[model samples]
Target: MTVRTDLLIVGAGPTGLTLGIDLARRGVDALVVERADGLFPGSRGKGIQPRTMEVFDDLGVLDAIRAAGGSYPVGMIWQDGKRVGEHRMFDPAEVTEDSPHAEPWMVPQWRTQEILFGRLEELGGQVAFGREVVGLTQDEDGVTVRFPAGESVRARYVVAADGGRSAVRRAVGIGMTGETVDPSPMLVADVRIAGLDRDNWHIFPPHGEGDGFLAVCPLAGTEDFQVVARFPEGASVDVSLEGIRKVVAARSHLAPDDVTEVRWASGFRPRAALADRFRDGRVFLAGDAAHVHSPAGGQGLNTSVQDAYNLGWKLGAVLRDGAAAGLLDTYEEERRHVAADMLGLSTSVHRGEVRRGEATCQLGLGYRESSLTKETRATPGAVRAGDRAPDGNLDGVRLFDAFRGPHWTVVAVGVEAPVVPEAVRVVRGRALESYGCGVFLVRPDGYVGWAGDQTAGGLGYLGRFGGR
Candidate 1:
């Protein structure tokens, strides 16, 4: 049997599900497929950055995400069975009107996926489990994908979100150039343990003499503690329950019996890589499929989610709104650069060359160099073209509330703005520090696409995106 859809998404992880929800809400027909029978059952990506929380607000899942997670706990260093001192994990950040979410939230990757999956279903999207894309072929018109069972699918566009070892990426002959970030192997698991307080992330520094660093962090909103341990170079990491208990007993003050239950466990060597290209013909690569990051600084999953957010609206515009197909080319141009930079940041964090501070939170990241951005003003203010639209009150209306949905926003900030197409929303208000004095054209993904001091070249800018 052959199924057909306007967009086919392979690998229903956070990236695919996020794109699915965005497309579904835009009235774009998209299907997400997974090879596994269910969502991934691990607590690998447990840290959700503040920028992603803002994205969740726009996607209509902020309430559920906030309910399912809590703020990260402070780190507690241990020495010889005694608590030495408390170590702050992230830099102190105060929540303000411009930046609402200031800290990273703690939610296991499994739970995050479940929440996104539920949202996808609520948006009238579908995910077909037990389906794997074994083969693929794309032409000028569309792409045809074949499964192991001989069933096939035809889609106007195919996106590969199938993780680090992506079959679709391999089939399409894209190359990933990268290097291993760490020489040692690491074990991560979610287990129920006793004799450890849940107030802080317990840390046991390396004992030198061949022993590696160990840390046990309490998974907020759940009863499990995520255990992390490093092994010497060229050593194998045991993931069994007994092995995890032994490691905890050997590294910390607790005994083996302290680990009462073990839910899941896995091990991996940290590595970072980026694909040569994000798109090929009618196919595109997303998430780990396009760029692989070290599980440090909590960037992989958050970056992946943003990738889908960036591409979803462009796909919707080209496929449903009769926009020029050239708009699709910007996806690779904008996202590939961000992915490359993020890969470098992840590598730095893994090697201890940088701290997980403002950069890891991802609030400062933007598409200032994107070709889609137009800054016609000679002296742009604090906020310029391609900057993330800050949240604030304008004209007695909340900015985020006005920008929430599948519509472009033409904001007049302390200036007379040009009139945009009726399909776009117009908000007139005095300029706050969140946005500077000018006319700002906000994209669906919450970035200022174009900024200017007057109406000059306003319509010309909008015309490129099917706006006027």
Candidate 2:
């Protein structure tokens, strides 16, 4: 018998799980399905940027995420089997009331997924593992997704978060346009090392012309050290324990037996690609399915998570909030451009043209050009419509506290608050430096949707999203 869900998410990774949690809290009837028998077991995409930290905060998993991870360690470079120099993994940023998380946090991807899954469960959400989509058919009403065992699911909307080799993306005939960021194949593995200190991310530069760099980073909150080694162009990477041992021995002072255990291992050639379109009818592409990025800048996962954050609210608006169906179109219009920009940033980091600092943190990403954004101020403040709303205190109310739920928020600073629907939360105060004299309508995703010197057009902007 076929089951029915309002939304079907095709992946159990961070992207799909994040979307599931967001929708679940919003009381949306959503199901997440994974082709694998269990969650992805790897330490890939371990860095959680500052922007994602805010998203996690709103999702009610920030404290758990913070407990499960630690700040990134400084890089320790070695040469001639001895300590050589030091390098900072990320340029530092000061933590302030507005931006709390200043740097990236290190949490193995597996642990991160587990935390997200647990939160989803707490919100009364469920995921069906081994439910691979073998076939898909969609019309104006909804999409019917088929599985190999003759089971099927009918969803009003389908989200493809199934990773780079997305079968759903293929079935939908979406093309990915991209280039190989690097010709050299790299091997990444999570292993227990007997002779390594967990204090620093060990780096060993290539000693010869044909050799490549090797980095072993300690996965915070765990004993596993992620081993990443680059190989020459056109060389095959071995992902087995023996292969990893060989690479470790040949590149560093560590002996072959130093790598005690290989928990997970994988190999890939870095490439940057973007889906020609993020949506086709009722199905949407997200995460690796939408845009594949090099892991250099730690952007792939963060960008993917934000994609869900961006799409989740819009889906809730259309499916539950009685908003206009046309609002869904802004998902592609807003996210595709952000994805494109992030793709370029990751590629640049891979090429060493950029550093893992502010750009990598992702706090600066916004939708200034989005059609959904309305800036009616004669002179916009530092924070404008389409910019992220900064966290601060306004008349004894914390801004983030007000913006936490799956609802719109109005930050009226040094201005009289306007009448708004009960669905919208309002915070009024004397003066928030981040936000000058203006009324700001913050979206569910924490970005300012409308900012005005006066409350003239703010209500009309809110009406578009069923806030009236």
Candidate 3:
């Protein structure tokens, strides 16, 4: 069988699925293929940061996530059943009221995928289950993707979101570069615990006879909690219910028999790795295919979802509106930095540093490489160059009323600027300082383009991407 699509997404995980939904919502036809026959089970990433919430809100799925299992504001840090520090997600002092959704939410990756999958289906896209990409070939025009079930797909672009062990990435010959940190062989189990607290995540360090550290995270939609235990270096242990109980007993004061029902369990060697390149011709990589890091900050899934959000609109713009080919290259330039930043942040967290503040991995990411980025003499941090632009109200306009849906916005501050093109929506405002100075060209994915004074070189900024 053969099929054709504007974009062929190689994996049906959160990254690929979110990209599929975004494309479908934009009336772009996308086909997503996955090897898994059903929704993924297990508790991988549980914390959804505020930035991701903003992306979901833009996609019109935040309400559903809020209705489902939502995030708690307060999280606790513990050591040997003793509380060390408490972290609250929203700091009104650090964050401005201009940002609509400023708090992070907590939910299992499974639930998040379920919500995203449902949204994808609602957007008129479905995942091809039990189909895996066995081979990939790309040319100047398009990509030819072959699946395990004697199926071939032709697509203008292909995204590799096929997890850490990405076959698509390997097929494209992109080498993953980075060293495995600690290789902390750990057992991640979702089970019912008798006396475990269900409110906050509990981290129990090695006390005495235990060979590992115990991490307890509350599971949404159930009284049970997810437990992660890192075994001693080079220690091998079974991942079954019995093995989990033995480890739990050795680490905590709880008895081995206290653990009753074991829902799911798996062992993993936590590693920090990033792809040397994010794109090669018509082939692109996002999510775990691009990078893999320890789950310390719960950033794995959120980062992947954001990658799709960042890349989807660019791909859609190019496919639908004749955006220049160079526009697509910015995906790697913008996202690779994010992947490297995530690798560093996760490494720090794994080394036992308490990261207190808006996670740099989430907040510090920006797209300064876009041709739309304006030249500015402003110092760093004074202007939010390459960061996600802040959302604010325009005097009489209501909050989120501007730039609510998927559309590029050009906010011209000074009157000396060139006439705003009809292709871009112009908002005349004196509050350019809120977003930044000069003419702010915002991409459809909510990243900043040019923010400081415009150039007299015939709007050469537009010419960079063949824009009007």
Report lDDT per candidate.
Answer: 0.91, 0.95, 0.76
In terms of lDDT, the poorest run of 10 residues in model 1 is 459-468
TM-score of each: 0.98, 0.99, 0.89
In angstroms, the error of model 3 at 105 is 1.6
lDDT of candidate 2 over 274-366, digit per residue (tens): 999999999999999999999998999999999999999999999998998999999999999999999999999999999999998999999
lDDT value, candidate 3, whole model: 0.76
Native-to-model Cα distance after best TM-score fit, residue 213 in candidate 1, in Å: 1.2
In TM-score terms, candidate 3 sits at 0.89
Model 3: per-residue Cα lDDT over 135-209, one tens digit each: 889999999999776889999999999999999899989999888777668888888888767777666767766
- Give the distance in Å from residue 100's predicted Cα in candidate 3 to where it truly belongs: 3.9
Deviation from native of the Cα of residue 35 in model 1, angstroms = 0.5
Runs of candidate 3 exceeding 4 Å displacement: 72-95, 101-103, 354-356, 369-372, 376-381, 414-423, 452-468
lDDT tens digits, residue span 1-468, model 1? 999899999998999999999999999999999999999998899989999998999999999899998999889999999988998888899999989999999999999999999999999999999998889998898999998999999999999999999999999999999999999999999999999999999999977789999999999889999999999999999899889989999999999999999899999999999999999998999999999999989999999999999999999999888889888899999999899999999999988899888999999889999999999898998888999999889978888998889888988888887877888888888768767788989999999999988877877877766772
Give the deviation of candidate 3 from the true structure as CA RMSD: 3.1
RMSD of each: 1.2, 0.8, 3.1
Candidate 1: RMSD over Cα atoms?
Answer: 1.2
With a 3 Å backbone cut-off (N, CA, C), the pairs that clash in candidate 1 are: none
For candidate 2, list the clashing residue pairs, or say none. Answer: none
